[model samples]
Target chain A: MTDTENTPKQTALYDKHLEAGGKMVDFAGWEMPIHYGSQLEEHHQVRTDAGMFDVSHMVVVDFTGEDVKSFLRHLIANDVAKLKEPGKALYSCMLNEDGCVIDDLIVYYLSDIHYRMVINAATRDKDLAWITKQVENFSVDIAERDDLAMIAVQGPNARAKALGLLDAETAEKVDALKPFYAYPMGETFYARTGYTGEDGFEIMVPNEEAAELWDALKAAGIEPIGLGARDTLRLEAGMNLYGTDMDETTSPLISGLGWTVAWQPEDRDFIGRTALAKEKAAEKTQKFVGLVLEGRGVLRGHQKVITDNGSEGEITSGTFSPTLKKAVAMARVPVDIGDTCTVEIRGKQLKANVVKPMFVRNGKSLLEA
Target chain B: MSNIPDDLKYTKSHEWVRDNGNGTVTVGITDHAQELLGDIVFVELPEIDTEYGADDATGVLESVKAASDMYAPLTGEVTEVNEALDDAPETVNTDPYGEGWIFTMKLDSMEDLGELLTPEAYTEEAEA
Candidate 1:
């Protein structure tokens, strides 16, 4: 994954990244910035003030047809019927026949006949194919939005800073937007959604104007962050990375995403309903939990987890939390696991405190100090 | 380009060594190595008196992106490890050649210094 045989593709802000001294790396076959200079500094900037990210690599898919609502309800694990108001968003896992997650995505209810989804960058090819295959019985037209670019501005002052770029009326309308909702102001669509657990807007703009908007945001004092900080921020926010936390072979029920499953109105069977129902009824099932290392050395992915009850598990994702000044991890362990366990880091047994998956939100630590 | 001090010896694995004029020598990763590693968050050092063969893994350095093994530049016995790095691993990124010196070792043989790479040779290899 580190090297690429073919030339990697670049986004609309490629030149802008180079001007900012971004260190480019091959991410999901695209040339993306890993950091401008210091990842820790960029992370702290986003947590304390405001920072922007070029997230244009993620695919934006739009579905338009009379059957959009019904099609979505049958496509993803979440019940899209709950998206009653236009511009409302639902986070869901698109599962396969065996009730295993294919990709986790956000779907917006634009209208009864129109919907939009934003999926992970790495899963582009497979996700498109899967969605196309499933739309065979519905009257939906899947339109992949390749002509657009996405930029996320996040932090304590992100919203106000972003709003400063807009006209008064448009800014007022955007400011009134509820969380998980979006509104199109002129050519740009603003969503009150982000991955960094900070108050912000994820704006989708035309590719040709992306650089101008980026420069404007830079002039407004929002630092340009890279993928390095994005990973840590999302991890600290207790959100799951699709490929790392769960994949095609892992069910959402055991992936710490059980809350995303909408099991109401039982007659509306989604793609993985039967298998998921069976798993939900099963007596013994492993659970996804968070771990805070209580010893030296950084906890990392694939490290062995030994529960106090003699059960075993593995860390799905782990890193040294810059905010907490300690190592934190998300792991899959036996349901009977207790409050604490040991992690094997290079043949050393290090104790760790088990807690709810979330560690931080909106610039505040959820964990008790 | 990374700074390559004329007086120091180098290893292909990126460790730079300073001969202390005695049986002991100080060692740390090069500026090029630290730049490649990015924002280092944690570091693990070898215990004093631990012996290792030339090219053996001696310690661990972890950055936000990944973890890397710090190899011994020459066969020696560990004399001291930088305790300051226990709290400030970023020192390696900020000043790799000074206070960030990872450890000092008592050489098994002073003749081993002849096998090390000079500034010119190290510059060629590093740029290549």
Candidate 2:
């Protein structure tokens, strides 16, 4: 973290991003591309065809030990026991003692004793410290895989394009990979999971092999996407951004992530089980919902929302959704709020319709026309 | 470097001024400004016939990245606005200097143009 703070670090594909006409910007201490030429076009490219994103800035940490599963169950809010098979993956939120989310990550069960976890770049340092501290009584060794680079290939055609890069036998095996599953081939790891709602793969390769893979992807007619479209795509998919949608001050229950919390098997205790149980018993005061602007103007984060009954809320993550061709946002509002609300933008109140957080999936609008 | 038409005047806020030669002047964000703001998605233009002081924030140009305020180059009365921009704000990104013109205004005085920066001066500031 100290090293990343001095200057913006570059990913292994930095030159490739530059050659692809990427406009670099400082994102979480890394010089990452915001877009190649047009953010809108890159967004459409992903929703329509295949697009690749250099997500090497995200930290990949590996955990291995005799008690790995037990340690994970105690460290994270979700149950890792749900990963019953090798190569299975689970999405969970690591919570603090007060039941607030520390980070949301994906953990892939590689073997009986080894699990690989990918966390946000911005929360790298604290997440490591927290995970390490929780390993006190367990026999676990934590390793941050800095030598690995991650690339997410997404869209309807993403799987076929990615599979083409593998040998026939390997392609056949990966072709049969189920959702929420992963396969490790030699040094590279491929997961049939992604942040985008579209079907795709999040592949991890050696740092030295990243540019080669990126060139191959480009030659295969996969357009390179940037962080700008990545944000919009994830928002449309109803995926929560770590710092923007929820952080240490917010619990997953009130953040529209209650489904991620494993509350069954009451005896199975996790880090924040007590606090979360207390909150559940007390009843949630706020709820998360989606907002679609009824008129013109883009919805953006930090905008205030006023319910019909005068209760106020705030937009968490928002953007001009290219797929929907309208402004869409996720907001935390009064639990009893109705379907209609007003978003305050640039001193004017704009009406919005509230619905489920998800706006689009698989290049199709989920909202009724 | 962004294109700076030598025939036009500019402001430090990145608005370009074109002398229409009939006591009216056309204004829009400079190419450098549009490049910095990125893809423009919405434009909020001031109403026609509205009066504005020099350097007043007259309108807003919202891009996919963020929103920026377009300012008045000199004291003027808004005579007309580009209605096309209301539906196709992306013209600002594609043609910031031509079809992207935001509004036309009647200048309070022709002498006010002297206070605006020349193309060379603007280039120095924008490319610095």
Model 1, span A51-95: residue lDDT tens: 999999999999999988889999999999999888898999999
Question: lDDT value for candidate 1?
Answer: 0.93
Model 2 CA deviation exceeding 4 Å by range: none
Q: What TM-score against the true fold does each predicted structure earn? A: 0.98, 0.98
Clashing pairs in 1: none
For A1-369, candidate 2 gives per-residue lDDT tens digits of: 478666999999999998999999999889999999899898889999999999999999999989998999899888999898888999999999999999999999998799999999999989998988889999999999999999999999999998898899889989999998999999899899998888999999999999999999988888999999999899999999999999999999989999999987788889999999999899678999999999888999999999999999999989888888789999999987898999999899999999999999999999987
DockQ of 1: 0.84
Q: Candidate 1: which docking quality band?
A: high
Tens digits of per-residue lDDT for model 1 on B6-98? 889999999999999989999999998999999999889988999988998998999998999998899999999999999899999999999
Q: Which ten residues in a row have the lowest lDDT in candidate 2 chain A?
A: A1-10
The local lDDT score (0 to 100) that residue A165 gets in candidate 2 is 83
